[model samples]
Target: MGDKLTTKTYWESYYSHNHADKKHIKTVCGYYNDFWKTFIDSKNESSTIIEIGGFPGRYLAYLSSKFKLLPTCLDYNSDTSQIEASFRIMNVETYSVLQKDFTKYKTPQTYNYVLSNGFVEHFEDYNHILDLHVDYLAPKGRMLIMIPNMRGYIRFYKYLVDYQNLKIHNLKCMKLKVFKDFAQRHDLKVIHLGYFGGFPLGVHQKSNLFQKLIYKGHRLVFKYVANRLLLKKPSRFFSSSIITILEKQ
Candidate 1:
């Protein structure tokens, strides 16, 4: 009924307000860890990664540790002092934070990996965003786009728990076909595209006692039973997130 919450002001306000909260930072790091573990490997140890729209830099810190890459973070936020502080607190040895709008800004240097998580969905011109991300890739470089999947069990559970939960999502859902078509149009090769995170085990500081209990139960089940049963067939319709991995042509 009301307009979607997709403005830059909204996010700037949200991040500025919650940037200092340890629980929120932990949750973001945990989410990125789970999503990236499915793709990152030892082969990327020497690759250069640039994260567009990365603010408050937790995910960039994770990538630096996991892949041994000095990642560059580009965001449009007016102030990046807090993000810099976070990098220091995490003991991230090498990283660059630039204050620029990736949607329009051009860079002279390209990277081996262009990555964004939960970023593109906020913009209506998602096609343009994808093109910009592709433009930042070097030859044979990889691009990873991750967003929430609306058709997943997490959405169902959120709605069951609180019907208004969907309103917080600016865009409804990112369809898999949309990413495929975008890649095909740009002549990029799709290396990986699938749903992931079937269990709700990430950190959520605002969750009520019941929600926390549910997350804990899911973690136990995923570690003991679900991991073994779903080792070979991990793709599920009820996964919480959708990941698309692309390589330049």
Candidate 2:
């Protein structure tokens, strides 16, 4: 736990307050839908699935209807009131809700597919849990992970505006190289990896229309300058977020 705030309390409060914040939550759901479509691509909807760190289970509810089955949702904080409420609201069946810490929980079975959104970033020992997941992954099964990009231009701007700092190091940023190396170490194959929000209108949500339009334009302009002018070199430091897909090697 970090000294300034307890992680469990932080997450509990976040989900409790933000789960029903319609616009923001729906925008997040849209991102999940888009990313899942990219990976599944017309596959049968009744695929066996599991989601680690399934906060509030809103995505799980959406996915259950779309995929034709309720997914098994696992979380470290099952005691959170929001978590319990989510389970009731989502009407999730066939779940193994555990309150155990993620670092201590071992993977139970080789799943056909495992999905996590904004999960790996919070943990200090992320790789260990990742390795466990890979070990329990069925052959050819896929693991999808999404993370905020630490080196993104907007984050750079945030550093200057919010903290008056020229640079900031986001511990959550898992560079592609580092991810690839981790995969290789675990005998997992890197199937697909890329940025999510570096194009016009790519943001999931914004506070207002003006902010939306401006940020959308900012994303496009930066992407153009990063890709065309810099020969995509700036991409290493300019993507707003990252999505990684991996298969067992």
Candidate 3:
């Protein structure tokens, strides 16, 4: 599928209707913040950070507020006319937000930190965007990537879930071994890789208090037991929402 048509159908639909879960949103923001603090060593205040696929400006704004650095966000959703005015606000003074397809846009500037949360997998060609970002990065620059795990527990339960009927799941997920090989081939160092979000498979069923309690217990056990023993692979957790930080050599 063409980039324009595929992006609109997948991103706009999710941003408009599916991304309303407060807990999921919180986990995402926290993940990025921790990554920044761990990797940047308080030096992010002076660096240029670019966030790809930042929707509605919430997480970008949150990161901007935390690091005190302006984040340039590139997104495919150009129809800002449909988004709420409150969702359009950004805090960075030096940063610019462009609503364009990254695959087609060329730039002369390099960034200190190139970050994309749940974006690279969406494109038909993963290496294409990865090469672009690596080329766009300054020497010693780092990149933070987050994508859904294809082998994660939640992905197995998709048939039992109704709201996740979207076809973008391919873009949303990747096998870890394949990803590691790709990163190595591209000269991107995988400095860290691990699970972040709790298994998303059972989150939907936790609508009621009783279900929520049971789900919470299940999550705890899965994290320490099922994931460590039964599944043995960390990717089996929560449909394997994997977060990885890569640095260009």
Candidate 4:
């Protein structure tokens, strides 16, 4: 999140009503998908992972409990109750929270895995954001960065719907070429880099009558057509997300 655009309260307020409850939050977070499994597994149970800007810790809770990996969360949000509650519900015991600005926060310790879901696209500076993530990442450890694919055909739908919501996101970070450049510049190896998932139009939003009708048709069509398509061969035109996996020298 950008300091100039989004304040700490913005996140707290956003997440306050973002979900119905701690348990139900996982549903909105989506499944950890087949694409993620290629990089999600750990070499050891003690291998640590940290989620930057991971408020609520949905992914952290699931990864920690399922893989028995130690987890940490870094965010500007001061409240950790929901994150703690998520861990408790998942029966995760080894987890911690780093409550502060991720861009500004300094840490002597590094983690085995560093990930950020739907993050890094909020700020204006991708170079600074990527550098910060690398700063706290351990050598040979994988850093996974995922962001919504707004540059695709969905851009038009979002423009017709929530244009303001689109403004906060740095859609350029969703580009594969951008991350490839970063990896080369930093001497980090790209493990996996590509688009993922077919386009999903079912999730609703406030829109005009015409936009609503158009999106409704999309909802019906994508429900069947897009669902059956191969996820590994995601195209930049309408893929739901961009995933990049990098390892340091």
Find the 10 residues in a row with the least total lDDT in model 4.
17-26
Candidate 1, which segments miss by more than 4 Å at Cα?
Answer: 1-5, 16-46, 152-165, 168-173, 199-237
Candidate 3 structure quality by residue, lDDT tens digits, 142-241: 7777776645445444443422442444643366665577578778888887765445544432255754565567667776666554334444445456
Q: Give each model a TM-score.
A: 0.73, 0.70, 0.73, 0.90
- The TM-score between candidate 4 and the true structure equals 0.90
Q: List the residue pairs that clash in candidate 3.
A: 152-239, 152-240, 153-239, 154-239, 199-238
lDDT of candidate 4 over 23-99, digit per residue (tens): 56456544555544666665577789999988878888777776788899988788888888888887888788888
The CA lDDT of each predicted structure is 0.70, 0.60, 0.61, 0.77
TM match of model 1 to true structure: 0.73
Clashes counted in candidate 1 amount to 0
- Candidate 3 residue spans exceeding 4 A from truth: 1-5, 17-28, 80-91, 163-166, 171-173, 202-239
Q: Give candidate 2 regions above 4 Å deviation.
A: 1-6, 18-26, 41-45, 78-94, 161-172, 199-234
Q: Which candidate number maximizes TM-score?
A: 4
Q: Rank the candidates by lDDT, best first.
A: 4, 1, 3, 2
lDDT of each residue in 40-109, candidate 2, tens digit only: 5246656666777777776665555456553666777645455545545545454445566655677667
By descending TM-score, how would the candidates be arranged? 4, 1, 3, 2
Cα displacement (angstroms), candidate 3, residue 98, comes to: 1.2
